[model samples]
Target: MDTIVYAIPVFMVMIVIEIVTTIIRKKDYYRLNDAINSLSAGMMSITSGIILKIVEVTIYTGIFSAVALMEFDSSELWVWLFAFVIYDFFYYWTHRMGHEVNILWAAHAVHHQSEEYNLTTALRQTSSRFILGWLFYIPMAIIGIPPLVFFTVGLINLLYQFWVHTRHIPKLGWYEHYFVTPSNHRVHHAKNRKYLDKNYGGVFIIWDRMFGTFQEEDEQYESIRYGTLKPLRSWNPVWANLHLYSDMWKDAKATKSWKEKLTLWFRKTGYRPADVAAPMKMPDIHGYQNYDPALSTSQQLYAGVQFFILLLGTTALMAVYHTTPTWFDALWIIVLGANLVMNGSILEKPEQAIKLECLRFSITASALAVTATLMPVASIFWLGLGSLAVLSLAYLRRYSSATEPTAAIES
Candidate 1:
């Protein structure tokens, strides 16, 4: 939470800097605001995962603290430094596995969704890392690093990675061969087949070098195509996760055999469409691709204003709910993770998903209110907000899906 608090101000400064630089260069691209909004969806997904991890770890500690009893009672900086390195090692492997495994890719895919690369792209992180990421840190627990120290270092490592997302910074001199820099990270985000799974380092590129997964940003031979092999046409956060899943599901269902259906989920994306047709040609997707800035001034301005307001409101909401949970807080997390998915579901040409997500959000919000009242968090605050959530959801559901959308709502 402290890390989240600190990042708020940092995000503000970088956003401003990104804008001024873009405008000064007169480089045409989509509004930086749209890119930032996309970042929010990315962060929301990450936040939800964070809350879930807190809940799980609290449970893990509560249950295992006794069995895994420790003798140490206080501070030790050296131990923490050692722990940080160990944690990074764990992160390297987990990050690598995320790319290799299909299930893990679903969660990591959020970061790669942005068609453009910029400072905002750095903020585009996954919403589902907490689902399985904590398992990687169990070694720290086994080694007896206190939970407080573990959490602090994890936050520090995350904060460290955010700045490396920008293209504004060139290679970090000789340090380029040592730590993870913006140039190295650019390669990590690239989808060029050669750069696909390289540069899997957290703080130090040494790990990648030692592990043989390191790839330099080759200007001539190996270029970069940002974003995923598949594109997310809409802006809805909720749909981001489910869109691919839904596509896979539809294709799987259409398969002739049960075995084929079962394997489809594990196969590479776009697999089950099997004897896949010829590849459709696409644009460069990086260094001035996708939404052209020269052509989209109005949309960018609108999205920028909309996001500023939404984030302000969200920060206020977090403050209001500060007293709710001592164990785990999922309020903002849900908003960030599900917002896009819900928005996307609603926007599909068919309209069934939009209706379904509204219903789901309504049910979940109301149930949460009831659960809060019945549990330790029985504040009058949640009850009222939950009621508001229910009503707001109902009203949103009133929109007619029969008509073509005037604007894109889902990401």
Candidate 2:
């Protein structure tokens, strides 16, 4: 059973509850643009997962079948419990190394792009994690951990981490010492000098405490600063995923020595070629602000409406994804990815957003046309699309006057 899929409703409910609670408390934690971007990145991660999961399962299955150390029955409760702990043990190392290594950080950095820490921030996972992530769990396969056990425990571990990405929850008394709570995980996400590279455990905080990577959330010392040292100024999901890799590529190309180029990726996190590395300056945490391009009411409406529509499309895609041909699945991913890119542009209020949106709408319309020509599409879909397009243009026209001056929404 895909536990994560079954828990989607619960996740949505929790997010809504968090939003309402924060509002009721007279504190603002969720920003519309950041939340949308975070969710969009998560959507991309799911879409990518649909394609990459096959490779992951194949590799794990092949290795397990080839080397049968000892067949452990997954039906036993102890087996399940042991699998949970062991999987988390490996996850700690995988997550820790993800921060320490360069190429791995390229994929993991997407989760840290959002400056705001909220429930949606937890969903901002990397689409490329499957590339090297499987390496961590290969040990489980060698130890004869059944695939079913691994899958279920992995999902359980992930679901356990979801609730910790909020500020509403205070530290638990004794529970804080053993398990990961909101307080400790907040330190994990902090970019402050005192808290960097701390609290790498998933379900258990004991691992970090044991390994000396644990940092307590001390109010007297320094408040937590979320996000990486280099801010992701743009909201594009695709760029969010690839920006670090792009930086690494440029650094590699600029270096004179081949050894430097080859080893740059494997080197410590934030290590750049001497020629490329800028002088380190203390980060102005107080001056740091969230990236908020002043979006007009109409622009915000357009983004919200289109994103809702795309969310529907994404849900539909997930429903039929497994039944569809591989090509159609790939096409669905491309269309959705492009939508996210254009949506990011709209949020940024870039000059090119207009052109990009036109191209995006045209692509969507053309895809519908092609799809209709190939087979019968429901009339309701066409009706919805036509209504949405008309409403979008009307909103844009009505709100055009408000966009003359770009106002940055200060954090």
Candidate 3:
């Protein structure tokens, strides 16, 4: 079983606690649209992982079988501890290179796109990181670490980092020296001049300290600005994953020399061929503003309800994905992805939100009806989906005229 699947409930509970804590303290840490968008990107990543993760594990197992130096005993506690520590060591380099390399950053940038540093920000992840991220773990396989051990430690490292993506946690004086605390991880997520590209450890900060990438969160600087240098101005999850890759492709095509075109992706982060590089102004961090678009109460409620349905669908898919037919998995992924895209559109485009919702409901209903005729789907499933569609359409239609014009905070 995937360890992350088991962590979902704990993640939800922590998010709820964080939300309540922020409310009690009167802190403006969470935004509805941004939080939902973060989760949408995360769900997209997990759903896509249903297939990609298999490829990753297969490749790792193949490499281990062919070239492992020696086999380690899986039952030994020492072996598990060693693998856990070594995983973090490689994670530091993998994460650092993710920022230093252009193509890698294209995928890694999704996690940093959110302006608010809350619990949901921790869930914000890239669907495409599997493209090259698995290469970093090849060392473990070569060292003869069992795949199960590697996978388990990798999950532990990942789960450890989640709690650090918050504002409520303060510096733990001595512990900060060794582990990746919220203070140091906060610097990792910040786009501020001094904090950019520092603290790349997954669970341990010693890697950053030893390698000279560590930057403490300074009180002298104004409140730390969170996000990438070029803000992801839209709420679209698919675009969030593709925008940087798209920019890189456009730059690759526009550059004059063939060599520059081919090498741009391998060059340092944010590199552009001089011939095609436009004169862009550096962002003023002092006046930084989040990318928040206005939504009416009805629209917000619609987005929330729709997102909850999508969340339940994603959870159900995750629980049974390994046992289900591949075709079913593929279709579920598609339906869930489309729903997420439409939900993002509803958040950003209020005038068209009702229309989009109606279209989605109609298409879904039609698809379910067609599937029911050809397959063994339960009548209860059809009944539930029909009820949801009717109630959702009626609710949206009732408040369709109240949605306001799209408004956003200017950067």
- Highest lDDT: which candidate? 3
Better of 2 and 3 by lDDT: 3
Better lDDT candidate (1, 3): 3
Error of 2 at 207 (Å): 0.4
User: Which has the higher TM-score value, candidate number 2 or candidate number 3?
Assistant: 3
Cα lDDT of model 2 by residue, 9-78, tens digit? 6877899999999999988788889999999999899887888888888998889999969879987999
Candidate 2: lDDT over CA atoms? Answer: 0.84
Model 3: colliding residue pairs: none
Each model's TM-score, in the order given? 0.73, 0.94, 0.95
How many residue pairs of model 1 clash at the backbone?
19
**Candidate 1 per-residue C-alpha lDDT over 172-232 given as tens digits, one digit per residue, 9 for 90 to 100:** 6899998999899989988877787789888988899999999988767654667776666
lDDT of each: 0.62, 0.84, 0.86
Judge candidate 1 at residue 121 and give its lDDT: 72
